[model samples]
Target chain A: MKAFTVEQGIVAPMDRANIDTDMIIPKQFLKSIKRTGFGPNLFDELRYLDVGQPGMDNSKRPLNESFVLNQPRYQGASVLLARENFGCGSSREHAPWALDDYGFRAVIAPSFADIFYNNCFKNGLLPIVLDDAIVDQLFSEVAATEGYQLTVDLSEQVVVTPGEERFAFEVDAFRKHCLLNGLDDIGLTLQEADKIKNYEQQRKAVTPWLFADV
Target chain B: MGKTLYDKLWDAHVVDTRDDGTSLLYIDRQLLHEVTSPQAFEGLRIAGRKPWRIAANLATPDHNVPTSAAERTQGINGIADPVSKIQVQTLDDNCNEFGVMQFAMGDQRQGIVHVVGPEQGATLPGMTVVCGDSHTATHGAFAALAHGIGTSEVEHVLATQCLLQRKMKNMLVQVNGKVGPGITGKDIVLHVIGVIGTAGGNGCAIEFAGEAIRDLSMEGRMSVCNMAIEAGARVGLVAVDEKTIDYLKDRPFAPKAEQWQQAVDYWRTLVSDADAQFDKVVEINASDIEPQVSWGTSPEMVVPVSGKVPALAQAKSDVQRKDWQRAYEYMGLAPEQSIESIQLDRVFIGSCTNSRIEDIRAAAAVAKGRKVASSVKQAMVVPGSGLVKAQAEAEGLHEVLLEAGFEWREPGCSMCLAMNADRLGAGEHCASTSNRNFEGRQGFGGRTHLVSPAMAAAAAIAGHFVDVRTMVEEA
Candidate 1:
């Protein structure tokens, strides 16, 4: 897990709504056993013209130049700006993996799919939910500037733009702490090992059949 | 105090709680599919951990399985796509190494994880169930608390057999009055989604109540609960009843003999108390819900089968207008056009949503004595599971479908997703019974119109959507 502190990065806006995980990284790219190297295939269907096989040279593939991420200005953009229901479909954690792999540190949306939102925090990606109007303002601000960037401060729970405009956001304190300290879900659960063990004992007593494999 | 079904299930499963309303809830069962489990197993290996309770896990490679591929035991040799074959193989290896039960391809029980679980009696009433697949909501028909979990949460549950979660608000969608003839569970759910909109049920556990829901078969109940995700609710349930018990009797995984009586005794108490309060409630008259059809890219963009598509000016909001415009363009549809008049190049009759025995019978009933339209390049009926396929075959349902020019294929989530070789090519229009209708959902540049199996079958024969009830009357 990577500890996320305050950082400024250019914003790339994806204007579509209900952008499901299947589109973020199609099922074909999900074949790989390991988590890494998904950056190239991020939005594989929307990013590339031809079919993307495992281990193919992505550089030679015809890039969907019209897509937001493939555009010249948005290149190297670490902040993703988007609309509502940003990750709805399958509960594939690969959606966040592809987003993080594509060099995004944060995703700002009016709303996000529940599972995708949860997966983002676990993978060290900051998913900030804001009011629709605030998101609209950010989109306009990014469009107005040539190299727009926003600074997200977890400790302060705010995002700042180039004009020194501050937008407050709410995050669960525990989630904020975990993201700031680079704690994944497994790591946090392990901290409460004793409690979990005690619960397991109680569960066994009530439902002993659960402990034995059939 | 009176309690809702959601409350009863949650309160029973709470192992611990915190100040912020988060609770560590015990999971009674975890269903695993190939698409989502690989990463979780990899995470387990990285963390150097084993599944907390192997007995609690049941897995099968469904989403990417080639339905026509060799028998269950033959390994990946039957699959041609290296990527898909490897994905299924990885599950086989992972399950074998970890000692988790694997229903490998060719096994009669190998089917959609959601369908197999309930049929085998692994999905019991009053239990907390989680699956990596969103359709896990299907299991909630037995009066259980079930929802989809992400891969990380999958790994968490695999390691701890519990989830750290906040309780969702309870919602009761009461459907009063009897449904008119030709309406099925699919129509009821589609109507609900249409009335509530896509995000209407977000962050709520929606319980289907009223006489309409109570009268549905177990399979029909599963169909409605299965598409709860389409309405933006992760959890959907119906109170357990005699229908649920009758369906569960003497199944392979069910508690046997004396224990079964005790289990039924417990399940009987799992329904919402009469005086229980829900945070939100919506009412619908079942007679008002006709067989439905989706005319656009989103599931919520739906209308009754007998209705005409809305004109662009009818969109209530700018966002909706934009979405409607895109959907119209992508689906090659026009406003004011009748849904029945729209042509289809293909049709699909499977998915966890509508792939049970009853669903097949419904479609077969419509397909019998009807020949498919020539314009339909392909019309396929894929069963939900191998067992479903076998039973359908024995009952001559497959013959009825085949005689009607429908390709009666084996089970698995074939063509519901484009992961497998069974998918639509560019610009193909398909009347699909699968859950989603998002852009590029079926395949890139393909158009999907979500419908019921009966509707899809009718579309296959008519080359477009038709009033299935009208056909029944004509017959």
Candidate 2:
């Protein structure tokens, strides 16, 4: 995981709501064992006219000219501006891997699906939740400006727009800490291994059947 | 204040709670399938960690396993697609190396992880279950606190058998009144998603209670809870009952005689207190529900079979109007177009959501004396697992399906995710029993109308969406 402090990058606005994981990274692309290469097929259905297969040359694929990310102004965008319920389907972490792999450092949305939201934090991709009106304002600003960018400060917990508007967002404290430090969740949880074992022992004593090997 | 079922399950699973309200919730069971587990296994190997509790994990190669008889003859080697074979083979290798228990591709017990879990009694009441697949919420039907996790969290749970979690608000989706004839849990859940849009249950663990919910069989309850993720809630619950106990009675992983009694006694206490409170409540009359079909891309873009494609003007907000407009263009349907008038190229009657024995029986009942319409290119029934396949075959349901021109294929998640040999072609419309109708879910450029098993079967025979209730009445 990469540590996040402050990321300032061009904003790409996906105006539609309920932009599901399938739309983010389609099911066909989910076949890869390695998570890193999904960047090429991010939003495969919307980004490319041809059906995306795993090993195909994505760079040579015909780009859907009308896709927001394909537009010249939004190229190399790191901040994704989206509507409500972005990443709404599937619990595929591939969705986050694709976004991160595609050079996106953060996503600003009115809301997000629960699993996708959690998946983002694990991958060091910040998913900032602001009010719907605030998101609408950002979307408007990004669409109106040619080279719009937003500064996402994880420590400050604010998305600073180009117009000098600082909109604060809420993130879980533990998640914030992990994102800021780029901490491995496994390492953090393994530190409390003794506590977990104690709880397991007590639970076993109360319900021994659960411990039985079948 | 009395505790809700969600509260009871959450309280029981808390290994440790931090000041920020994130608890280290102990996971009692995990179900792993091909697509998600490979990456997690890779992560574990990179981190030099083994599964914290091997016995707690149950795995199968479902997502990418071919359902065709010819393709399945040689087990993993039989998978036709190279990429899919690698994904499934990775699970086999990982499970073998990790010494985790698994039902490999050829194993009769092997199927969708969610289906195999409850069928094998690996998922039991009061246990906290997690899977790499979102449909893991299906296990919550047994009063378990189950939800989906990402690959990173899958690896996290592998290294430490606990998930960092905050408590979710409780929402009760209480369905009252008797459903009309031929109504299934699929209908109820689709209705629920329609009543509460896709994101309605976001941030809440929804408890589905009331007479209608209790009236559903264990399989039906599983079907309802299975799509809870489609309803935007990670956890979906139904309190413990006689049906739940009866369903788990003598399964392989179930407790022995005395331990079974102990387990049952504990499971009995898994329900919500009588005076329990909920953060939100949604009341529905079961009688009001009809066979549902998703007209558009999202699960919330659904209506009864009798309803039409909603006019753009009917969209409550500008955002909704855009979504509906996109759906209309993609689905190739006009506003006010009748669902029944929509022709289908294929019909799929299997998935973790509806491939259980009961679902198979319902589809078979509808297909018994009818031929699949010539306009329908294919109608296939892929059972949830080998156990479900054998059960359906023993009941002679497969014969009825085959006689009706429906392909009675081998058990796996065939066509559900299009990871296998079964999938829709571009511009093809399918009446499918799978959960999501999202764009390109079944196949690239494929249009899917989500339906129940019976509805899908009826659609196959009719060459279009027809009311399953009408077919039942005709019979």
On lDDT, the leading prediction is: 2
Two-chain DockQ for model 2: 0.85
Worst 10 residues of 2 chain B by lDDT: B412-421
Q: Give DockQ per model, in order.
A: 0.56, 0.85
Error of 2 at A41 (Å): 0.2
Candidate 1 chain B lowest-lDDT run of ten: B67-76
For residues B356-412, what per-residue lDDT tens digits would candidate 1 score against the true structure? 999999999999999999999999888888899899999999999999998887678
Q: Relative to the unseen true structure, what is the C-alpha lDDT of residue A20 in candidate 2, on a scale of 0 to 100?
A: 95
Best by TM-score: 2
| Clashing pairs in model 1, backbone N/Cα/C closer than 3 A | B72-B105, B72-B106
Q: lDDT (CA) for every model shown?
A: 0.86, 0.92
Report the C-alpha lDDT of model 2 over B16-115, residue by residue, as the tens digit. 9998989999999888888898889898888788789988888888888888899989988888899998998898899899988999988899988889
Model 1 residue runs over 4 Å out of place are A200-214, B69-73
Q: What value of lDDT does candidate 2 attain over all alpha carbons?
A: 0.92
